[model samples]
Each structure stands twice: as C-alpha cells, then as structure tokens.
Target: MNKPYVIIHTHTSIDGNLDIMDLQAFEEASRQYQELSLDPEKQQFEIQGYLNGKTTTEDNITHYKRPELDENAAPVPEGDYVADPDAPMYYLAMDTRGELAFEENTFGYGGVPSHIVVALTERVSNAYKDFLRKKKISYIIAGKEQIDYDVMLDKFYNLFHIKRMMVGGGGTLNWSIVQNGLVDEVSVILAPIANADPDGHRFFVAKDPYSSIEETSFQLKSVQELEHDTLWIRYSVKKK
Candidate 1:
C-alpha cells in the first residue's frame, strides 16, 4: 500500500441494521452521507476514490448483457486507465468473478464523479478480459482464487495513485478489509432511531464462527450532531 489509510464508512440505524427500509430515513441519510463524504478537511484525506462490493454495485445496475469467460485464455494485461486525468473516480467494485457488464468506461453519477473499476482475482477468464479490454474500463487483479485485499490496495496506490480510499459498501466487503488489518477509521452517521429488521445486516459480521467482535477494539475519535439529529462518529480501530 503506497499511502496506507482506509476508512470504512457507513450509515446505520441506532440498532445497527442496514436494511434502512423506510424511504424517508433512506433519503435523509443519503443527504447527510453526501455532505459528510465530500468534506475533505474532516476526513484528513482527499478521497482519490471509493469502493463497492459486488452486491452493492450490482444492486444499482439496471441490467445489461454479460460477457463470457474463456477459462483457457490468457489473463488480461495488468494496468489502469483513467478516462479524464481530472475527472473524479468512484465506485471501484469488487467483481472478482467477472459478473458486471459495463456499457461504457465512465458512467456519470449525480454530481459526483462517475467511474468504475472491476477488481478481479487471477481466476477471471480470458474472454472476460477481452471484454474489459474492449470496453476500456479500469481493472486490477490480486489473489489467485480470491482477491488479496492488500495486493488490491497496492494496485490502487501504484497504478491509479489512490492514496487513501473510502471503503463504501456492505458488511462483507468492510469486514474482509478490517480482518486484513487495513482499516484505520470506522466512520458512521448514527441515525437517531433504533429501527429493527431481523433480516437486516449488522455493522460487522465475522467470517469465522469463532471470531469475536468483542475482541476487536476501537477508540471513539470524535462525535458531533448533524442537521437531522444524525450523529457523526469516528472510531479509530485499535491494533494489537
């Protein structure tokens, strides 16, 4: 990792559910998320980019044709491509299985930089590589079977020049990064209510059955109230 700092940022209810089913609550949090997210001074890092897990990225995709992978084909040459040197980069998706179908290299988002990068494992097929090569979208590969989080981050640092990235996505992706000892800060917009949904995801979930959340320590960095009674809190993940 060239410049090693990552903040796992999320918005969750008081009860720790990510379901966020209520439309009103979703809209409010989203508004606050944008405000807090773009504030460069507070975060202490100009977010060169951000990330999304497969589920989070796939959820927003409307639908499109997917590419076929040829298992025997050579791996795509390792590299990066920026549409515009100054255009902001957003939503680097962890699509290790080569599942996403991008219509173009740069897809515009609401006032924010609209760009995408597909993170891949070495196992991704050659045909898919050809598809990505044709599309001219940016991509990086890490582990052989699964994405090596550390290597992936290094690619961002070395190739894309992303020093500090905002880890913006679901628990699985967040937890994987945390478990790899890559997370420095746990930032959240604490919603006022304790909305419950048994089906909803938690702030963090361990992959190993024996792994304990209690064992992972954190020191509260700062706390402040936002416009809508939403609390912005930052916790520094304490290392052993």
Candidate 2:
C-alpha cells in the first residue's frame, strides 16, 4: 500500500531522555523544536499535517469544547473514506478511544497548525460521533479500538494528497510508527543538559514491552548545533 512520507521530529536531552516532565513544558520544548527544525533540509520537506498521540494532544491543545451532536448530523462516506490532504495545515490527533473533545474544526493552539483531524477507532460511541459532527471537526476511523497507523496514513495520502507528514509527540507514537516501518526519517534535537528523569520516557519505545534494548540502524543525514547548546541530528531509517 502506498504511504505518505513520514518524519518524526522530537527533542530530548544529551542522555536521550524525552520526558522532561516537570523540568520543562511542552510548549517550551516545542519552541525549541521549531527553532532547530529551521534547517534547510527539514524546511525543504513540505508537510500537510503534524500527527500527535492522544496524551500529547490533550496536554498541549486547549480552547476546544464538546458540543452536542446535531440531530441533522451528516454521515461520512464509507469504503476507504478519503479526503484531500494538501489544502490546509492539520493537527491530526490520534484519539483511538474517542476520549477527546473539541469545539471548532481547528485547534486553538498557537505556533503549530490550526486545522485539526481527530483520528478515531470503530469503538467510538455514536454520541461522540455526533459531538464531532457538531463541532465540524474532521475525523477518520482507523481501526476497531486502536489506530491502524499505516492504513490511516495511506488514507491521508489518498484523501488529502499529503505527500509528507511529520509525527511529533510521545514515544509510543514514534515507536509505533518506526516499528511499523512507517517512518522514513528521524529528526532528533538534543538539548545539551542533564534533565533525564529516572523514571522518564525516551525517544523510541520498544515494540515488546518486556524485551531488552537492542541496536537499531540509521544512516546519518545531517548534524548540527543550534542555539542554546542544542544538537540537531537527522537520520534516515535503515532497514536491516
């Protein structure tokens, strides 16, 4: 199946810990991401939407509300229900459990894109469906309970013509994408500090929860130092 080009843009510490927790807020690190990503290489790749996991979306996104679904709610089409991805910027939130609430079609967050796409699963209740319709926010059913990242990504390409996509958020989302061979590239912006959380998360979450750490391969594309003693590195995922 055809898939959109995917890039996971994220930041961490020199020790490779991504969960800054109480040490730094997401917006602050996100600002750092924006600054470091100004590299000509990343800038050249056009992205239609930036994808985020449910937790990160809820934490970083605000100013949206849940309104009652309309009695005259419109039905979304079936059979690989598609839409064009190239028109406007989108913040695709992977909310498989139908737990998110939004007021407008777009998120009110600053800096990042405005348009929002709430990715859902079949298990989402009809009431929630109505809520989304009432809000006029776009969504796609990816699976029964959990999201099928590959299928949804292809849907993004087919419906929206989104050729390039960037996924930035938590380790679970990034690890899932890489584990599924969905990511073509990885961009890491490392803050040169020792803010590692003893019980914090890292860049990539392993596919197996109990498995020991193993070596992964990547071809270094570019490396540089940005302002604030940060190290910006880009690497192409290499299949072994």
Model 1: residues >4 Å from true position, as ranges?
Answer: 1-3, 39-45, 62-65, 68-87, 107-110, 208-214
lDDT of 2 by residue, 1-240 (tens): 668889999888766687654554443555668644333344545776778876687666642344454445565454332233444667778876666766567754334445677778888766677666556677788777678876798777777667788887687788877767778899988776556567676777764541234577999999986665666789988897
Off by over 4 Å in 2: 20-30, 36-44, 62-86, 108-112, 207-214
lDDT per residue, candidate 1, 43-149, as tens digits?
A: 44467777866776666662645655565666655644443334465557776777787777765443465566778887776777667767777778777777878
TM-score of each model, in listed order? 0.85, 0.80
- Residue 75 of model 2 has an lDDT of 58
Candidate 1 structure, TM-score to reference: 0.85
Q: How many backbone clashes does candidate 1 have?
A: 0
Clashing pairs in 1: none
**Residue 178, model 2, lDDT:** 78
